[model samples]
Target: MTILSNNSQVTYSGTGRRKKSIARVKLTPGSGKLIINGLPGETYLQFSPNYLRISYSPLHILGLSNEYDIYIKTEGGGLTGQANAIRLGIARALCTINPENRTALKSEGFLTRDGRVKERKKYGLRKARKAPQYSKR
Candidate 1:
């Protein structure tokens, strides 16, 4: 993704994806308050603590979790996918603030985009690869 905005304010903006989820992330200097889809991050992702942890890992890794506010508008997938996508978005946005951050994010594998997705089912198959058993008669 690319920086959608930058200047004196609105420090950075970036997009991130995982599976089918897409996250639009905005980074600003402030007390770390993460908001998702207009809801507080903790409230929006309360389904699992893991979701919170995954989405916050990048900031935690950089030791800037409390220095920047993260706002995410994510859609197109389940909570797990959205969480991961947001994680990537945060890492990428951080890169804009400091190019050196790329090394740390890359070293931590946060910059690598996951390419695995659900396989399409073939005609006559029960699922992606399962097939019906033939009758011997």
Candidate 2:
């Protein structure tokens, strides 16, 4: 939960990193009119069902102002990663919305980036850090 200075109507943007993808979300103080590349809610399902809910439901959470415009730009990774990225971005945007609520958001661990991901295999003719054909003869 980082506290950022309040900037006037500049469309507060936040960056969230998850897995192998990144999400950039822009938020403004206004009626809830979430616009994603000029698409409606149905288009979100095309990418992923999990992500669709994460992106479009953050505002509905308690202590969040419903009046706002949410815009998200995400690239790379799978649907799950995208959804996580969106969550982080939205949490950051909340900071810009009301610096006072930073504590609340932080308590929920929303402002933190989840750095857990699949590990790559090591060069050993087997899985990562694992050896093959161990004979106990």
Cα lDDT of model 1 by residue, 1-137, tens digit: 34435365656887889999999999888999999999999999985789999999998898998998888899998898899899899998989888999998999999888988889999999999999998899
TM-score of 1: 0.91
Give the residue spans of candidate 2 off by over 4 A.
Answer: 1-9, 47-49, 56-58, 63-65, 129-137
Ten-residue region with minimum lDDT total, candidate 2: 1-10
- Tens digits of per-residue lDDT, candidate 2, 20-136, equal 979888877677666654564347547566666676545656445467767777788876787788788888877776787677778777878899987898887587667898899
In model 2, the clashing pairs are 30-67, 30-68
Name the top TM-score candidate.
1
